[model samples]
Target chain A: MVNSWLELGAQKKDTPVKHNYSIFRRNCLMGIVLAVLLMSGPQRSWGQSEKPSIDFFSGFEVGLYDFYFYQKYNVVFNLTPGFKWNMGNHWQLAGQARLTVINQLSNDVRRFYPSMLVLSKELKAGPVYLKGSVGAFSNSRYGFDLKAFLPVTPWLAFEAQAGLTGLLTMAGGWGMSPMGRFTGTVGGDIYLSRWNTQLRGVVGKYVYTDWGFQAEAMRHFNHATVGLYAKWNNIAGQLGQEGVSLTQSLAKGMDGGFKVTIMLPPYKRTHRTVNFRPASHYSLTYLVRGMAQYRDANQLYYTDPEENMRDGWFSRDLLKWGSHTMEPDFIYKGKEETE
Target chain B: MKRIKISYILLAAMVLLPSLSHAQQYNGTSGFLHIPSAEMSHEGDARMGVHYLNKALLPDTGFLFQGEKYNTYDFYLGITPFEWIELSFTSTRRKDTRAVTGEVGFWRKDRYASIKIRPLREGRYHPAVAIGFNDVGTTAFNKERTDVQLYFTNIYVAATKHFGFGGNELGVNLAYRHYFRNYNDKWSGLVGGLSFRPAFFPQGRAIVEYMGNEFLIGADALLWQHVLIQASLIDFKYLNLGLCLQLNMLGKKYVVAER
Candidate 1:
């Protein structure tokens, strides 16, 4: 009699499962609607001038373990399509919409995070670039981030960022009690023609961290860029006082990963490429390198030929000094060389 | 309501004034992307151009929503003094809101000069190269807004190549621009565009531009011998329209077919 009573109770408990199904259906529908709307524009070739263009991006990443959830072996899938708009010579706006799906292989659990929207504004002035955005992350966290990049010299640039976010607990009993937090990053980029390195110090709530340091290096190829990053968190390991393993702090933790990005062509012209030039047009090796490559010095060293001619004034005579006889008469053609 | 009435009145005047001129010449070298072109206007030709940009279409909510009506008006007087050089003076007025405060009471007016120079001609394989300075003229104010410097300035250099295949012609232009200002002063970005005329519409042409950060789609059509109409959708939100009047300030010439 008791076993029959329990069976009846189990059948009565189907309402919650039905409710969860309804929520999942709603989210899927929303994603489909957004995808359709973004892809509905005219099919003509675009991004040819000072206007806005649309592009789509997707990424898949596998993590050995989730630092925050303490889950072993998880995979993340991201789909993002964005519109980039140029306001003027100095300003740009980008609307980024992203959907993320996280799957944990160990427990055979799958979770779908809500779509996120981010509007980022970028401004450039002289040697400084500023980027700020207000958006929600796929983790059901809403936030704003402000970042600035300042080029102290041609080969070195400093970057700083600060963000504020409010987290919401979700499936798997993770992120319980959802609290507000602040995060900051300070970094610098070292650039070479084909390679770049970033060293950053991060402090905030990312997989439970009071602070962390990261070093990343990327190599650029003709059509793709490959990068690897290593991170060390919380120099001192700290455990949560009252929480499960999922909420336990991952301080003093270490992790590393590799990423590859492929660029599609009919590429847009933007500062992302030009800013990599080395500072000081008078670098001795740059000229020799240009000559060795049989590249046009005008095209390689300057944005405009007129500017190239003017800049060559500095290194031209230097190049001629060793090439031709450095006679006093040849050197004193004008006193402006010394003045 | 009063502001809307004044806008209508101004637009009507702009459309009417172009009809007063009786020059039987339309300009073939007048089209530009969002920025001025490296190509000059017809030699010794002068024109008055007006442009209106309305950035008030997005809803007040989403990430792309621009809260208030942000509108701009640009009036340009452009002249081609030499076969390879063009000069333009522009008066621009903008009405926007304070970034932090939502009040729509902010307004600014700036007068600037634009200069373009074409140094190389198109050859069988080599493209035509042109260089230009955008918004070069400004009265001395703060160092940040100074426009006279060349390095880290608003300079754009472009190279255009024309390709003809089976009677269809397409012009591809690639440009590099560097701007010197706070936060935007250090680096340069690449932007390019394609210009072509449709077979069905011989009198009209379309320009598609990727200005590094955004994309612009627009069309320019000749309404009359001396009148040209220009319209564009900026970022798929604002509808920008323009009316240009060409006049023979110094010599007589008619629009020539683009080569």
Candidate 2:
């Protein structure tokens, strides 16, 4: 079946029939151009157009258990790799992928990992440059996110966000089914020099088969950020269980952790510039934290271990970076050996 | 002969008192009343009441009232212009037995208002549904927020028989209530209850109610045609057993010919 499908695709590509290869190729080229315009337009206009940009961040935390079964403190870790491109003016397109790992100390649980992909659009709308992400996380279970920022001053600004996250049935274990969760938060950011600091408190609710309250606080510092979150889930009622009867089933708990991120430059030319640089951007970040989780046994247990680690380092010089250069000047000038 | 006439008049007034007080003009009007239970050690427990109808009151306007229990007394009033809709405002005050540990009295009071509606009007056995939103203001908390507001909806079906004390009428009701928003978040449970009311009596009428997992019973009586009295006893299931009283403004009158 796979071979047949591939043969059909290849035949379509070779055929010059109407609505075939030419149209597909045109659409693909258009998509690539649009993506390039959106990702590079802002960075070319912003300051530091010449110097390559890189961001680095990381953090750590301690977890504690306060329940009936194995009660102890543990550790966790996380890491992220990100890239930012100036689209033009004060606008930019940034992309990041986060990898998280969790380890339980007492129970000897080896690894629980999740990943997030973020595509953010940032623009200066008045005094503050608003930033927001329109992306998906965890295999696209979560929906979209909308965020806004208003600068009280150049150094400080107020920010707010509304997000809908999907809780997959597999992720919720036995207690909760797959459902969408709504979250809203309002907070402020204080930029101290190159180091941008943010503090935000959030309140929201999860509406699944069962509905419950959700709250969280996050502090982001430049490339590194830390977050503390708590959820009070009530799933038993939807399963036809009475509230009083389910009160002893399990207790809600909190999860908190620190995360770091490294920003890498683009692999291609910074823009449609005449000069072609032979170096690619790269980043590496690490994070560690602890979580207090509640199990169905009505016990609070602390599970903490090295949570996440990520590394992304690359060099373009060996790959003849400018061989496929697109700019007219770069094509005409040819590649030069940097001694 | 004059003395006899005066005695007869007095007797007539006494006989007409209860009907005159309980003769409500509207079908779906709600009011607030304090509940006093004789069976419980604590006598004064107050609650708010709301009702709505389509056949009574104005064509479409309804009325509501709220009241609190002070020791053994309850005060309430209501108005409804529409038969299908009603609104009620209520205030309740009671001593907090659990707050005896502090120097200040554990007396707490709450004020709230609610609106209700009934959809089916003409059936002998009709299902009545109502949804209400309430803002609870309590004296115990210094800063009041809308965090504790309550959303409640219920559906009930009732059947009436035309044979009470004098072949008048009697109604039996069964209802299920789902509390949501804030109240259900704290107290999660399904409430099913039953109510019974007599059509008429020599003077007025009476109502008996039962609810909760444990058998809880409550009763209310109308007197002097305008005044109502009620009480109840609650069991282990957090059901309230209480009594209540209402004063009627309109009473029935009968004509007699002199011999």
Candidate 3:
């Protein structure tokens, strides 16, 4: 099933500059470390020998923004044109540009900005897929964001991202400075029959330890995939209003949305589908290939005539793996030499 | 003798460790996007991608240290229609003024086309090889004038390799560039550098290079796989910051079968 989310928020607040910088640095370091560990994890070995594919497509997105979870409304219209290059070996690079037009009920001036641009690189490392990107709005640095998906099982995967926007808070304030705040989203996805569902617990400065749940059911036609979803959010922080009980937090932040995304095909080697595959690439490939070609270890393979003939087609010793064992008498007897 | 044996034992264990894991697999070469380094990874985006790189500082008022820094923004769009071949268009901002003083009123820009072709994939014994041209258009700030200050054409050959032990990977890049400039001296020398990404955080890298007779050091941080922030120091005195957003254009999909 195809599932995605488009979230936008902005606010401004004055905080201690040193504290903000420290928090940003710490989180940045933590994000990098986590990416490394995830990439280095044990991987499943699903692979296709084919090369990667490339394409360009465009779509439109419309969202109704509800202020105070009430009737106050602002509508946002976005024209998103995207270019994607799936570099067959689990590395995908995509760039997206957003031409956003916002119509606010509170203001007469229609705000339209063609300033949103994003470039992203995604690596499917082992069981975890990590994506990091830089975004620019109006020729200035907008912010940086990262999303990671870790599969616990075939049907369940854990998801998390740095959702550092605090407009989700109720002070009628917004901060558009990206990566300026330290917040994160922690959640999991359940792939049921015909449905992909997400239940997330988000914490940090913005959401203030809130809970969000989303359920999307998607259907595919010949070209496009359409999905409808309803999301409900609950914040652990109290609303400070008098007589507000526990149920108020749950009932107040209800949002229902639907999205129609069309995909045009040539999907043979694209691997952009919802299907999961075993990862073939890892960091150890380099080290193993390097050490295996060390002088003394390579001597055993070249000395034997049959071994040399079998590996002759390959130019580098690192590529001659089958018969380069440490044994001095190792021979290339094919399958019979297994022991 | 004891220390040598211990080192050998450690090296042996490292090579054999991956064999113990039955499930682990090697995906392919991994490295940064755009911001080229001496490290060779055969992997690139499959389609067309656009990136914008900005050089943070240029001296205002022409060489005399007016205590003012000029910002030069470069918009670069690259497309790898084929895996090994990349064609790119770069538009750079150049400052021009015939008046010869303070905050030149005229800003001229030019577009240049370049191509990078990787002839061979990097192996343990051999580096990945590429040949490319920079400032191919020879487009200049002022073509009408008798003097053009910002026009130089260069063709370069580069070799990049990755050396890794466990999770630690270091990329070494060696490049030779031949500069074509008629106004000032001919015969440019070798330009090369090294890049390193820590094992703990592969998303960020530190790079140092000597290009065009100037020493440069910088770092690139990739966030969310889309945004790249680069900060560099040039010639020890000038600091430059570049921010780029990478975007991809996906071709129309044709679904042939229904699962």
Candidate 2 lDDT over residue span A236-296, tens digit each = 2232355544444333232222233322223222333333332221222111111212122
TM-score (chain A only) for the predictions, listed in order: 0.46, 0.37, 0.48
Q: What residue runs in model 2 are displaced by over 4 Å at the alpha carbon?
A: A1-71, A74-102, A105-114, A136-143, A152-158, A164-182, A186-202, A205-339, B1-259
Instruction: Name the lDDT value of residue A295 in candidate 1.
Output: 18
Q: Using Cα atoms with residue i matched to residue i, what is each candidate's TM-score against the true structure?
A: 0.34, 0.26, 0.34
Model 1: fraction of native contacts: 0.00
- CAPRI-wise, candidate 3 is incorrect
Better of 1 and 3 by lDDT: 1
Specify the CAPRI tier of model 2.
incorrect
Per-residue accuracy of model 1 over B206-227 as CA lDDT, tens digit each: 6677766667666666555567
By DockQ thresholds, what CAPRI class is model 1?
Answer: incorrect
Ranking by TM-score: 1, 3, 2
Tens-digit per-residue lDDT, B1-259, candidate 3: 5634543454333333321000000011122222233332212222122222223233223322235434555555443433465555554555445233435532444445565677887776999888766554342223344454433345667788867766655677777766445432232567677776556556556667776456766565545545545555555444454454432333222211110
Q: What local lDDT score does residue A164 receive in model 3, on the 0 to 100 scale?
A: 31
True contacts kept of each: 0.00, 0.00, 0.00
Which lDDT values do the candidates have, in the order given? 0.44, 0.31, 0.40
Encode model 3's per-residue lDDT on A20-118: one tens digit a residue: 567667656765665565455434421421245554555554644333212323565656555545554344444445555654433422233333344
Weakest lDDT window of 10 consecutive positions for candidate 2 chain B: B34-43
| Tens-place lDDT digits, model 2, residues B1-259 | 5634543444344334444122221111231111111110001111223222111111111111122222311122232213454433443332333333443221343333333455544343443343323321221221244564332222222222222334444433443433333423322233333333333333333333433233433334344433433333334112222222332111113211111
